[model samples]
Target: MELTFLGTGAGRPSRLRNVTSAALKLPAPSLSVWLFDAGEGTQHRLLQTPIKLNRIDRIFITHLHGDHVFGLPGLLSTRAYDGGVGPVTIYGPAGLQQMVECLFQLSGTYIGYDIQYVEAVEGVIFDDGNYRVEAAALEHRIPCFGYRVIESPRPGRLDAGKLKEAGVPFGPLYGKLKAGEDITLPDGREIKSSDVTGACIPGRIVTILGDTKPCANAVRLAEHADLLVHEATFAAGLEEKAELYGHSTTVQAAEAAKRAGARKLVMTHFSSRYELEDAVQLVDEARAIFPQTEAAFDGAVFDIPCQC
Candidate 1:
């Protein structure tokens, strides 16, 4: 799995960065993209990358702020025009359906695919056997949410050599062994799966939060996350202003990652006042607290390695 930052600037677009949006690309057998937000010019950003609009199967909106959602209409319209006939599911807070429908009505836009809207609420929002997403209320001026994506653990690899040594031939039996099932040979010899399998591999955890100040929910959602993508809207010394605007400073974002025991952090949603070079200093401030912190910019990709 991997995450790509589409736009990292906060509030508005600048020469250095666009607005807020990110793409979480999952691996097969579900090779699809899930968007965290669709800020202004998001569809344009996707055009710059290899990701196709048709592969975007899910969109999770954190809030209704213009900077965070102004591009939704354009993206949805273009997806149909680009021949995306598959269903698209959107998860967001209350009034999301009404807002999107209102825009479609006013624009006389008709989509070729179905749109499913799920109202944001605390607890598990989506589960498809392989992965599950949990949503929690965050501390933002608006009713924003933070999402924790947990991948299901995979079965351990089968010991082919061990099975061969035990007189088990390669075939469907190997498949059963890999699935943690015991089987008996045609000669009536029994084989235990545990004796020929390695330990189960643990799944990865990724936490992505919307704009918010340092809060308990942010830490809770990021607990033990392999990657925590949080907003650092200001420099270290701008704590007062950050809190006033319901945003987080560089240091605060690091503190939340450290407190949550996250393996690494990528801070985004930077204030437009900071230039491209200023991202280095902002990241340095966060590194002082959590050494694994990184500053996210447009097209930045963070890959999550498998435990195996």
Candidate 2:
């Protein structure tokens, strides 16, 4: 799995930053891409990366803020033009379907592919065989949600040595045994899979939050996460402004990471008022409280190696 930041600016676009957008790439056997928050100019930002727009199968919007969803209509239309024949599912708070429908109606745009809109609530929103996504309401101006992405534990490795010791011939049967199936040998002896397999390894967990102030739900969503992507829209000294705007400060984001026991903190969605140097300072402030804090930049990519 990997995360690519397409835009990191909070409210509006600046020379140094764009609006909020991110892509989470999961490798095969599930070659899938997930998009979070398509802000203004997201389609333009995506053009800068090597990612194919047609590969995005799921999109999760945090809220109805202009900066968070302005690019949805254009991106969807472009996807249809680019020969995206597969179905795409979008999950967000209430009114998302109406908003997209209104945009299509106003523009007279017709899509060839099927699009499904799901109204997000506080619970498990999506669950496939390999991963599950859960959401919780955050304290924001609107009904914003933070997502917890948990990968399922992988199967154990095959013990070649044990198979050799048992005099089992190497073939498709080895694969079945490694898959935890009991097999009867040629001599009528039963071989148990657990005897020739190593222990199952656990997968990594990632948490991503939308715009919000310091709240219990943020901490809960980030609990024990391998990586916590939280919004840091203001510096430590601007706590009052952050609260007034229903956003989080650097210190507040750091405190949540520290309390949640997150291994790493990635801060994004910076306010336009902050310069490049000021953004560096904001990261430093968060790192002072939580050592593994980093501020995200446009087109920045982070590789997450498989824990198994």
Candidate 3:
């Protein structure tokens, strides 16, 4: 899985960064991509990446704020114009459907593709054979939600050379062996999957929270995640204003990642005051608490490696 941050700034778009949007590109099981938080000018940002707009099948909104969702209608309409035939399912909090309808109607923009809406609840919102999605409420100004994406574990590859050496023909028995089932060959030899297959690769877990202060639910959703994308809207020593604005400081976000036991932490939703020149201070503060921290910026891409 590859994560690309389209927008990483907070509140508004600056010359350095846009608003808040990210995309997860899945290569296996499905070739589709999932978007998180389509802030303003998100569609324009998509054009900058190699990801095709038609490959975007799901858009998970973290909140109803204008900075988080103002670009939805524009993106959807543009997708239709670009000949996207697949239906786009949008998952968001309440008033999302209403907000989308209002935008479509008010602007008189018509989209050719179908759009399905899934309201956010504090539980498993979507579960397919490949991935499971969970949501938890976060401490934010409005009804905001944090999303946890859990990828299913994949079976290890079968050793074709070993099987061929074992006098086993490439047939239905290979399927059984991959399923961890024991099978007897024509020579009455019992073969187990463990004898020929390597260890199974573990799946990945990613947690992405909206503009929020550190909370228990956020920690729970982020528990044992491979990557935790938390908002650091302010620098350190601004705890008072950070809490007042329902945002978290750099230390607070690092603390949340440490408490959750996540492997790595990437901080986004930075205040416009801090430019790229100020990244060292922001990264240093978070790294003081969590060593494995990356300060996310526009066009930042992180690749999650599959582990066995």
Cα lDDT tens digits, model 1, 171-195, are 8999998878899999998999888
lDDT of each: 0.94, 0.91, 0.92
What's the TM-score of every candidate structure? 0.96, 0.96, 0.94
Q: Which candidate is the best by lDDT?
A: 1
The C-alpha stretches of model 2 lying farther than 4 A from their native spots are none
lDDT string, candidate 2, 176-220, tens digits: 887679899999988998888888767778899999999999999
TM-score of 3: 0.94
Rank list by TM-score: 1, 2, 3
Instruction: Look at candidate 2 and give me any clashing residue pairs.
Output: none
Steric clashes per prediction: 0, 0, 0
Cα error, residue 295 of model 1, in Å, equals 0.4
**Model 1 / residue 37 / CA error / Å:** 0.3
Ranked candidates, highest lDDT first: 1, 3, 2
